[model samples]
Target: MRYVDFTSEELWKQFLPGDHLALDTIVKRHYNLLYQYGCKFTRDAALVKDCIQDLFLYLWHRRNTINETASVEHYLMKALRRRLARALSKSGSMEGIGFLEFKDVAASPDEQLIQQEQKAALADKIKKCILQLSRRQQEIIYLRFYLNASAADIADIMQLNRQSVYNLLNDALNKLRQHTGAYFKPAMALSIILLLVLSQL
Candidate 1:
């Protein structure tokens, strides 16, 4: 079967019926995205991989009991987030880590070096600003901007009301602007632009 044309919900339906190919396809579709999001929570790549593996294994084992969800991405993300939380708590690691990978887009070698330094400096500042946010606020910013999730999706993932998600997102952006006042232009919110850049990376 050509799973490439299937939506996540379609693949999920197949997986629920014990279709191994569908399960494999789902893993392929989401693994990289899940890995990137997982890394933001902790610096341990191995742990993130393990948690993703465990999440899929858990799904497979309980496929019959799992209900359909609006977003397969959000469901998997929420599950992975919980698993990472548990693992981090067990290991006494800080739950939030700002790990971003960026590419240099300069033309010349000297220019590339200059751009790399500037981008690195900006990334450091963004990381510090993100870390200063309350955990809930940080997560709201991440899901809204980095994941490009809608308020409804965020509410579903975070188990909050839609209005609460909106309020948190507003509050988080305000705090981010305050924290990043130097980098932010008066007309632009640095959190949105910077998070979008990081998401692409």
Candidate 2:
């Protein structure tokens, strides 16, 4: 059935019909993206992974009752966000919920070693700057820039009004600029700042 060739919505439709292959395909396609997004909300990789597993299981079990959706990625992300929040809330340990730890990738060879080291240092700096923002601000930046979510999509995912999303995003960017002043160029673009932030992810 070439499940790999199916669009997300197509896979979703197949899944609704109790097709295990379709469900597996859906998981394989979205797992990495979901895991990365989930990690931005919490540092516990295990917890993020568990929530994603549970999310898919819940969807599979409730396939008959779940309505169709135009955007499966958005639906899954919103569900996972809610699930993680509930789990964290019940544990009463939301203190370390906004940081993404830097991942070290090995340099290919000595010639590029210096360049890789510089990039790693910059990524670490951006990660620290992001960690200093409020949880909501970090999330807003992640959604808007990392995911390239439109203001309306972010409003839906974060459950904020579009205007509020704009306000929060503006405030977050302002704070990021101040925090990054030591390393940032006076005219560096916000998109570039975010791209550097994503380098570690």
TM-scores of the models, in the order given: 0.74, 0.78
User: What does candidate 1's lDDT look like per residue over 1-201, in tens digits?
Assistant: 789999999999999978988999999999998998887677689999999999999999999999887789999988998888788888877644333333332222234323555544555555666666666776677677667899988888777899998887788677666776666554545443544446444
| Cand. 2 TM to true fold | 0.78
Tally clashing residue pairs in candidate 2. 0
Candidate 1 Cα outliers beyond 4 Å, as residue runs: 94-131, 177-200
Q: Model 2 off-target regions past 4 Å?
A: 95-129, 178-188
lDDT of 1 at 201: 45
Considering summed lDDT, which 10 consecutive residues are worst modelled in model 2? 105-114
Evaluate model 1: give its lDDT: 0.74
Clashes of each: 0, 0
Error of 2 at 137 (Å): 1.1
Per residue, candidate 2 scores C-alpha lDDT tens digits across 1-201 of 788899999999889979989989989999999998988777789999999999999999999998888888888888998899888887887742443433443323233323555545544566676666777777777777777888988899887899998898888777766776655554544645556546657
Best by TM-score: 2
